[model samples]
Every structure is written in structure tokens, then in C-alpha cells.
Target: MKNQLEITLQNRKNLHAILEQTPNEDLLKIPQGFRNNIWWNIAHVVVTQQILVYKLSGLQMRVPEALVDKFKKGTVPDGTATDAEMKMVADFLLSTITWTKEDYEAGLFKNFNEYTTSAKVTLRNVQDAADFNLFHEGIHLGSIFAIRKML
Candidate 1:
């Protein structure tokens, strides 16, 4: 599991580089045929991790309610993210994972509300949610790469 987290963290750093160097205009632009922009995808990665790990674990989430509403599954780009918003997203991209690792190691995740994900996998424990989160992030990372190409 630690290996998985390390691999995912490394992938996020690479994704962060791509996003950091991308022009703001390109990050916000939804090229033709794309359903969302790079900013939304990045934010979604952060938001989804919170929901899967924190919310499902019956713990208070680190991200705000509005952010979760905006980026939860089944939602699309609401609008272009400003520079400040993008920076915030960039921060959470790494911070949240670090916090989760700390929280897991500290045994903060003692309960899970028991939710089955859209992929039909039931997460009965916090570790399951954490494992599932890696798969979820990988999908969104691919989306980010595809969206970046369109910009």
C-alpha cells in the first residue's frame, strides 16, 4: 500500500509540473469536444480523494463543501478557475495526500460509513477507500493529460 501511495505521489508531482508550466489560458480553455478543462480535472483529483477517503470514512473533509459540490463525480466544469483558484488546487493536489498518509499512520480513520463506489466496489474500511483512491486518481490523471493536449 505504501508503494502504491509513493507511485501515486510521484505521478502527481509530474502532473503538477505539467500544470505548473501550462499557461493559464490553456488551463482554462475547454478545447472543442472536451467536456472539461485542465483546471477542473486537477481540482477533481483533489476533491475526489477527499470524498472517497474522508467523507466515506465518516470524518470531516479537508476541502470545503462548495469545492466538493463543484468537482464531485457527474459534474463538469462550472467555469474557468482564476489564478488563485488554480494555486489552491495545486496546493491540495499534494497536501491532501500527505495529510491522508499521516492520518492513516496515526490511525485516525477508525470508521467508514460503508459505501460502494460507482465501479461497484464496496469500501468497508478506510484502507479500502485509500486504495480505491489511487485507481480513481489514475483515471483523472489520464483525463488531465488528454485535456492538456487539446489546449
Candidate 2:
């Protein structure tokens, strides 16, 4: 069994490969409801990594403030992202994952608060949070894949 951090890192790598194969124009189409495109999903994962890991661990989010509202959680895609902006976000996300992996492996977030929502599982530590975040990534990845198939 792989550790939580390893699993999370693997998932991030997989997502990056998926995005690399996905074209820029495919990132703006909405296949379903108010859900954003692949670009939004990718950005959300990166942003949430900063929020849930760095912030919870008493570290600052390295991402710029100007990009926060555009990629923050609950900010749906309105077909507003340009090719350059999408590339920027993608590069930032990849770099953030590289930085976050070391922190996670160091066990710096061992004492953070545990959150138990109405969801199917309970996260009690950084391990749980890492695992759950990977699951969250899967949800968004699936959504993106479905949307891409539709388009």
C-alpha cells in the first residue's frame, strides 16, 4: 500500500499528463451544468492544494492574488480564460505540486483540524486530507473527461 503523499503525488502526475493531452479549446466548453471546463478543474486542484495544505499548515499560498478569484473554489468557468492564462495556471499548478510534495512527506500537517462533512468518509489527519483531495481530483477529472467526450 502506498502512503497518502505518494498516492496524491501520483494522482497529480496523472492529471498533468491528462491535461497535456487535452487541447486548449476543449477547456472552454461546458458539457453539463454550471460546472467549469478542464482548465477550471485543473486550477481548482492547484488552488485547493494551497488552501487545504499550505494554509492549514500555517504556510502562505504562493499563487498570486490576481489569480485566486479566477480559480478559487466555487468559481465556475464562464468561458473567460485565454490560452495564455490557462497555460500560466497549468504551470503554476505543476510547480505547486512539486513544492507541496516535500511538505507533505515531512509530515508538517500532522496536527491540523479534522473535518467530517456529510460526505462518505471522515478525514482526521493530513493523510486523510491528502487521500480525500486525490478523490476530489478524480471527481473533477471525471467531469473533465466526460465534458471532453461530449465535445
Candidate that scores best on TM-score: 1
Residue 81 error for model 2, in Å?
1.8
The true-versus-predicted C-alpha distance at residue 49 of model 2, in Å, is 1.8
Superposed model 1: Cα runs more than 4 Å off: none
Candidate 1, 102-148: lDDT as tens digits:
88888888888999989999988877887888888888788888887
Off by over 4 Å in 2: 32-34, 105-107, 117-122
C-alpha lDDT score of every prediction, in listed order? 0.82, 0.70
lDDT by residue (tens digit), candidate 2, 73-97: 7677778677777677768756776
**Ten-residue stretch with the least lDDT total in model 2:** 1-10
> After superposition on all CA atoms, how large is the RMSD of candidate 2?
2.7
